[model samples]
Target: MANTSVQTEPGTRRPGVLQAVLLLAGSCMPVLGSVLLTPILPQLSAEFGGAPGGEILVPMVVAIPALMIALFAPFAGQIVDRLGRKKLLIIAMFAYTLVGIAPAFLDTLPAILATRVGVGITEAAIMTVCTTLIVDYWHEPERRAKYLGLQTIVTTLAATAFIAIGGAAGAAGWRTPFWIYLAAAIIAVPMIFLLWEPNKADPTDSHARAPKVPIPWRRIAMPLIVGLFGGFTFYVLVIEASYLLVDAGVAPTDTPTIGGIAALASLATAAGGFTFTRIAKVGVNRILPVAFALQAVGMLIIWFVGGVPGVAVGAIVGGAGSGLLLPSMLTWAVGSTRFEERGRVTGLWTAAFFFGQFLTPIIMGAITAAVGSLPVAVGVVGIACAVAAILLGFGLRKSNMAPAEEVTATV
Candidate 1:
């Protein structure tokens, strides 16, 4: 609010490391929101067992944020476009910290789940603004790819850390992990000084008034639609991996051990995320096929091999694929739109991505009910992801919709 315009001409000068680090830091909040509560879900259920439908309702607290993001991200995007990125981000970050910590003192499962909705609302704005700012700050496609890849890497690593932290905190008590949400406030303070609205208008200049271009509905819609499936593919294993391990014979009480296995998969994800810039050279069309193939082979391995070793190996392979998939879909989604509509497109992409995540459990549950096994359901999803990737890759290349040059060029 002090002065939105920090630069006379945007995308001319390189952003400092501090800015990139700050954006990357903010990007972790949504990822943190998604995974931090996971390690504590069992404790939450036990504590609230007296409540009706506590089993389902307690897990909803784990899942409600994704639903909220899916429902409200587009609106948050609109706000970002109209009100300005930095302002919404600052406000959302503060709100996220407040709402995120509220559950620490809540008495009822319903009350806690309601607070989770607040967490999701703030996360919607935070994710949309943070991603838009990254694109706004970096002009070159290669640099954007690098930062987004790094974003994935940081997110994956942060998730691994948070899972361990959540487990450790949960060991102390169910509510202790909620304290970590205060990390958002720590992030917001630096952001107040370091983060700025990119490409702000100069009110003194009449020529600064720019003509609006109609949003390319098809171009923007394609990646988002594809991202829905990408999100589904990425989350299937993350959501079901523990169940897969248990179904294979691991003890249900072994949460810490399961978390350790997940941390290893997170390493694999970080490996793939770290290579995103190099992979971007191949174009998303080519990358998509390879990513899904890894997932397909890995899922098939789990289905046929059976047991903890299989689950662990399959997860690492699948995690690598998911890591690549996120950045590829993101790059594809935002590549077509320029400054004017990137926020909205990014918001829609966030909505699509999280919506896919939100749908994963329900879809997998239906598949499990029909098939009578969670592993088979997971394998079915893997096969579907593989088929889609291959078919889409062929069409994307043949149609030349995003030719190599077009994919690499900054909008």
Candidate 2:
């Protein structure tokens, strides 16, 4: 309820490191929903073995939130634009904690899946608002790019942690991992005191009274489409690398080696994120293609190269591209929008990304089935990404996805 302006206007204080760190922490919430329960799906299936639709509903417990995020993020964006960012984020944070842990006590699969819907809806708001706020609080391009890159790095790291912790905690019982939802409430504590709304203008400000500018939907179409590809490629390694390793002859029980390769891939991704902060000045026009090119190269290696060495190499290289992919596409999508329309633009980008994630497995499955090989399916996707990289590199040369030049409000 305190003043919500984070800008360094005459009176408002500019948000610094603490705010960025909090936003990064908040960004990891969806990752928990995505990966935290991954290791416990078998247990969940067993727990509700007798329930109607248990087989399908069980996998949905992990997938439904992402679908909700994809479905509702644009609506959440509208809410952020109209209702303000901090209030929606705070309300959703507490709501997230409650519904997030609800499964611990639920008896039926349907009931638990319903709570996952709540988790998804709240996550839609949480992700939209947190991302909007990160750039809002840090308008300076270097600072903004740094945090954006860090967001990918931190969340990627968190996904690994969540999976491991989920596995470890599942040793006690499937319900125990749900307790980790407490992280949201714990993060909400500092947020209550430190996080403030960006651009909370006084009634007297002329621009504050000006009519809201509509988002340039046409201008954003290609970027969103490109983001769809980026999103699909981004999650390819994260979701499919384990199967890739197994297919390459690693034993199913060789978790440490598998985990090591996965971890190496993650570190490679974090390296890509770190690279983004330094290369961001080149603009998304250039960086976008490079990211995809890297991904394509890795996938091609998997198809043509073969063996555990090839698969491991492919994962690491593909992950590095993924690390660069998100931040570049995000900047490309929302960098031109002003404060009035930023939330909606960011929401659209978030939707495109998550929707691609939702489709990745289904699409990849079809590709694998049609071709009768996982590496070949991945190669086909990689070729598609390669074409996109070439096209974007040429087509976007004239257009720069640079952040809006002015931080001040404009009518």
Predicted model with the maximum lDDT: 1
Q: For all the candidates, what are their Cα RMSDs to the real structure?
A: 3.9, 4.6
- lDDT tens digits by residue: candidate 1, 61-144: 767788899889999888877778888999999999999999889888878888999999999999999998888776566567
What TM-score number comes out for model 2? Answer: 0.85
* Tens digits of per-residue lDDT for model 2, 44-140: 6567756876655665677678778889999999999998999899899999999999989987788888999999999999999999887777665
After superposing candidate 2 on the true structure, give the runs of residues whose Cα lies further than 4 Å from its correct spot: 1-11, 38-60, 105-112, 170-175, 200-210, 248-260, 400-411
Residue-level error in angstroms, candidate 2, position 148 = 2.0
**Can you list the residue pairs that collide in candidate 1?**
none
